[model samples]
Target: MHIAEGYLPPLHAVAWTAASAPFVVHGVRVLTREVREHPESTLLLGASGAFTFVLSALKIPSVTGSCSHPTGTGLGAILFRPPVMAVLGTITLLFQALLLAHGGLTTLGANVFSMAVVGPWVGYGLYRLVRRLGLPLMVAVFAGAFAADLSTYCVTSVQLALAFPDPGSGVPGALAKFGGIFAVTQIPLAVSEGLLTVLVMRLLSQSSAGELIRLGVFARGNARQDGQQGDEQGQDRQRKRVA
Candidate 1:
């Protein structure tokens, strides 16, 4: 979902940069708190960065003459926290631009704003909301992934509308054209991403990595902690009987 260089006008670029500044600052502050709270978790955050990098690097051709890649921000947000996902996403996009030419340096700020800031926040927010509502883990994962994809496209549409306000036609016409083309590719991609995210979350929930549940990674309720406590109590009872 990289908007090629020159697609956005100078005014739009400046606007996006200005709008994204607060998010960047907030993300940094959040990451700092996380580092202080759980210093060892930094290792996991770095691993998340690598995971995002790999996920974004793999592309699938779409019908819009462009390609789509897994954002992976939902997974990262679920694992480390949304702010950590933002940092990792920025790093991954920078590396992609410099090394693979997947996106342009000039449009890096815009790209970061849309994909990293908008997408991850949307996904993470939805995940948190659903978890609070006691939804199933898989359902939350799907919702998060779907929101992330749709938010990215909405950002893209805004960027396009701002850039080409009047391509001989009105702003509405331009937006329609841009949204139409993007929607064609984004719809199927969103569905695929939703399914994949649900599957991965389910797998993680079942694996030894289920410690993620304790860390508030998945959208599971506090029941996981209660269950762990109950199991510990049962184990203690068994030990007492043996003694």
Candidate 2:
């Protein structure tokens, strides 16, 4: 959800910025460690960011002044964890604000809080919960992505309701009206996003199995076994050389 520029009151803007600062800051640290520890992950990280940028850039006008689009954060959140996606989502939003003229700098904090911070965390948590409950990977992925996209809009509705309550019924009425309107377009979009995310994850499972295993997306036992086999093969080669 991209709240329009200066749509939120100044106090709300300040509060949102303050609320979002720690998450973004911690995300930076998490991203830095990921890159420093695993240089090969740079490409994957870039891919995740690009995926977010492209998907989110395709914004559709929703009810009121805001817009709705696929957050594309669930894939990154699942692959690298929510903290890394936080950085990626923020960057995507920032670029969109500057280049695409989609969202405004004044409302960047609220946008980031809803789309970047909350969306990823909700998705990642849902994914983990689903997996733990013995659900299939694709199913869990779909659930996570679906929740992430819808949750963003839900948060956006809350933010808008807070800023502009209904004259007749107050905050609750405003929330209901905004949320109801959002559901009209958002539900289908969320389902589409979830399916798309599942497709992407399937492709990654095929092409980037090793990296996924390294990232703990796949089971660690397989990686450990593979490492042991490699070590044994290396020892055999050394013995042959000595002989």
TM-score attained by model 2 = 0.83
Model 2 lDDT per residue over 61-102, tens place? 444446656678777688878888778988888899999887
* Model 1 stretches with alpha carbons more than 4 Å out: 59-67, 208-211, 218-243
What would the C-alpha RMSD of candidate 1 be, to one decimal place? Answer: 6.6
Q: Cα miss at 13, model 1 (Å)? A: 1.9
Candidate 1, residues 1-243, lDDT tens digits: the string is 887766677777777767766777777788878889989878877777788898776665554557678777666666666666667777888888888877676687788898888888898899879878987767788988888887888788878776777658777877888889878778888777777777666545444234665566633565354233225465465446445
Per-candidate clashes come to 0, 0
Q: Clashing residue pairs, candidate 1?
A: none
